[model samples]
Target: MPLVEINFDGLVGPSHNYAGLSLGNLASASHGGDPSYPRAAALQGLGKMRHNLNLGLAQGFFAPLPRPNGAFLDALGLSGVEPAGEAERRLRAAAWSASAMWTANAATVSPAPDTADGRCHLTAANLVTMPHRSQEWPDTVRQLRLAFADTAHFAVHDAVPACFGDEGAANHMRMAAHHAAPGLEIFVYGRHTKDTGGGAFPARQHEQASRAVARLHGLNPAQALFVEQSAEAIAAGAFHNDVVAVANERVLFTHELAFADPEGTYAAIRAAQPEAEIVVVPASAVSLADAIASYLFNGQVLTLPGGAMGLVIPLEAWEHPRVRAYLDGLLASNGPIRKVLPVDVRQSMANGGGPACLRLRVVADPAAIDPRFLLDEARIALLESVVAAHWPEQIDPTDIGSAALARSVQAARAAVLEAAGLTELA
Candidate 1:
């Protein structure tokens, strides 16, 4: 009955490029229109997966959602015919979107222990705030259904209605004594669709969306807690909850401005799990600007095999002086996070994602899940080889409309599908 938390990382899609699609994301806007190295990005992501696998953690992979989505274009009232105009250009942009690479937004997962059916449930995100990202849910739902298809162990639900924006696990967190234990489910919302309380940034995760997802999963209301994300964090570019906080097992590491009322939220979580540890980084020690810039809180505190914990962070944190000193102090002390490993996800980092943003945590009995989604040394090697040979080295924003680029991306995805024995997905 033991269940381990499995990290399902999104394979950086072959169309990975900077389109400056995210408005509130500082890095996304700052590095907009810059050329992106899709091959390098995918390889770095694969390397991270390999590192976790070596650490004796269960690792899973979600293939990039299909791009050049024609269905999306039709809905936008754009045709596929030639003699294309501005409308066609905009449509092609959505089709070539690689934002699907951030799988943390893929779905909100309710582990077997938290669900009424005693089965894990997943709801694909309806990323309605961003036009490019809004096109992802249908394809993401398809991918989720395929990856977690075992009905005996899993339930895959369609996204909530598009009227209410839902950003999935990026806005959800669960804290339990063990992966399989019934625990606290924290749903963080920024604004309601009708209420524009998000200050400077558009609040993507609606309270209604979170409530609907919890209802769909049949989560016990007593165990579920809904919280509003701080407008300060949102205005400061903490676009998602994972951007300001991350949780694993019994620990929740977050910044001071993560919630509207940090103290009250922490107390509720404590009431649920009296033994829960909440690590808050004071605003004076690290300003919200620096925290978002370095993505300090985005680091994952993974429980190693011997019960010790390690902090998996992006190289950006090591480069930030204040953040680096804080991390050093934590490791130097007798804290639960004993190890600090800096990974090179510079490509994703440049586009406003960090180590935490690349993954979706699914706590389940590995034996009960689909085997093809799991990865090992051999599969990692195969994925790396396929990416190097097929993924485009660089994709400029201008290249998003290129038919050749779109074809190359689809072909690269097909190669990965073939390697994973998921030709049906291809």
Candidate 2:
């Protein structure tokens, strides 16, 4: 039962739109009220999954959660009724948000090797920072339970209490000799209090929440590190740690301003894992603004089959002169990252998510996972065909409450469930 890392990406939902629901996400705010192409978004996501699969990696996917969530509307006392005002209409729009497609925020995972009971532990993220995301955990937990049903090898827990907001793996990083080995898990929190420096936005990941998650996972206190995300980074729109840094095996790719104390962070990591290779993109070469704009650190730094590290970034990063220059130098220097694979996720990038935000990384024995959730060429074709035939080509913010659009969105998701033989989720 050899363990390997499996990337479980969330299938971009048919209701994917730019409602501008996320507060700290600059891109989402900027793109609010714009027309969205759901069909193109879903297809682009599938293309990314196919890209990773072609790289000889084990890939899995989570079906989109039911949207225009009637239950959520009911909770808000807006079910089956027309909105009374602009505020109510905004509430209704929140119900249709497809932000759940960013599965990196779906859960916080501690691989078997890092936990006390020798089982992979996953806790659904509370995501209490925003109204739309707060509705995600319960549905996310239901999906997790189904996919990791083998209790012998996996433990899926409900989200930590909403009192302390937790944003999941987007704020977490793990470094080890290899995926299956015992790893040093680092949790990056925004602040200890609600009144903190993110300028105009809130610091989503609370320090208390990060500690609570570590405790729930039964991680050895010595092996766990809790660090604060730089206030400057947060104010500059590095809303999540993944926005500034990413880790894979022995390598950590990050920006110079990613943490409150870069040298201290590096020293701690080296002390915990002596082989840690810290690759910092100096601020002089790529400023915080450029890094955030390009989402340069929001890429998937993974180990290729040949045992060399490769980074999967978005086309936006490749196109940025500074980011491109930095990447070119990274490869020419014969550093830990040997390759930079650029992907087209403009649909997601436009809404403040990039390549890393689209997936969740889990380390486990593949045999323990539900096979239907795993992807193959046939399953990829099934998904592509379904999206092509059913997903909406475009959705305008003005069309959010239209009955015809709602029906189409609902039917499209149902079609995907049926095509993937996952009606049990429905």
Candidate 3:
């Protein structure tokens, strides 16, 4: 087989909690101060991975980043002491965030066929729009380097400058006849460098940042299309483009209000890949509110082993009346997407992520990547055992600063690293 798309999920960390640091993420804001179950969250994520693996898809994983980031807290002048104020406490919470588990925000990847060089390229996302996510790229780049260390097959770049915020694959999409083919790369941005739009919420992806990533990855100018995400979508809590839109192979599954100009966007996509199958769910059938709430569009639309496309959605989308009706109609219509497999990811959903958010898609041969980062039956069992033994059963927001929790979180992560033989990341 030629290069194949591998879904690399981020293993949910022991520090998983709900501090609600993300400004525009409605689920995070709504679930603030709510108790979180880290063990359940990690297990849910692992189960999703197992589901895909069983479907005969290529699966890989990135380990959780170091948390209770002492260096970050120290830089903020709050190290080695208890937080004395609400502002200081917020900083501590940010430091302890397990937000890195959402690997979709980890990097922007351009496969070998699309890039100038014959090697696949990945650039870590700067994530400068939110303070909590801003601290992610450095550690993200470290892991990217280790995983894609095969210089002949991959080239990993650090993030573009922080002046323009980049949210990685969350605001990007690729369309091709097949995973191995050179494809049209779409970089979606929420704001222009000079414009201050996005209404109540900040536009996280900058047009300039998207362009920078395209350049860094050495994508062909004509093959790269830069589109602006609609302000309405952003205000509706589609914090990233993936919230309202997702593309796999030649199909674009999106909400009606996903883009600023849906028709033009579709036209451009069809122009680039004439075989592109666009399945748009009208707002009447499933409103943007319902789409975002249920994360209907946040599911992974993947080509199954049997050649039919399957949508890996969250259980929330399955239970949603409008979303479910639309999906049923889609399946009945004999459309490109045939299967709607919903898995439980309630823990991640409550924290503002879904199946798509939990993964970073990389198109490459499994042999070209580090085997340790890849998943198998044995690896899955090992990971499940580690999470069951070490991950915190539940984490209250107030537990962010507890010394015992911090020790447990750190020790848990260390154990996972040791078990995986990836202690170098520790």
What is the per-residue lDDT of model 3 for residues 31-78, given as tens digits with 9 covering 90 to 100? 999999999999999999999999999999999999989889889987
Clashing pairs for predicted structure model 1, backbone only: 68-95
As for candidate 2, its clashing pairs are: none
Listed per model in order, the count of residue pairs whose N, CA or C atoms clash below 3 Å is 1, 0, 0
Candidate 1 per-residue lDDT over residues 140-225, each given as its tens digit: 88878887788998999999999999999999999989777898999999964246443667889999999999999999999999
Tens-digit lDDT string for candidate 2 (36-130): 99999999999999999999999999999999899999999998888989789878988998999999999999999999999999999999988
Query: What's the lDDT for candidate 2?
Result: 0.94
Off by over 4 Å in 3: 192-198
Lowest-sum lDDT 10-residue window in model 1: 191-200
> Residue 288 of model 2: what lDDT?
94
Ranking by lDDT: 2, 3, 1
TM-score of 3: 0.98
- What's the TM-score of every candidate structure? 0.96, 0.98, 0.98
| Runs off by more than 4 Å, candidate 1 | 79-91, 192-198
* Best candidate according to lDDT: 2
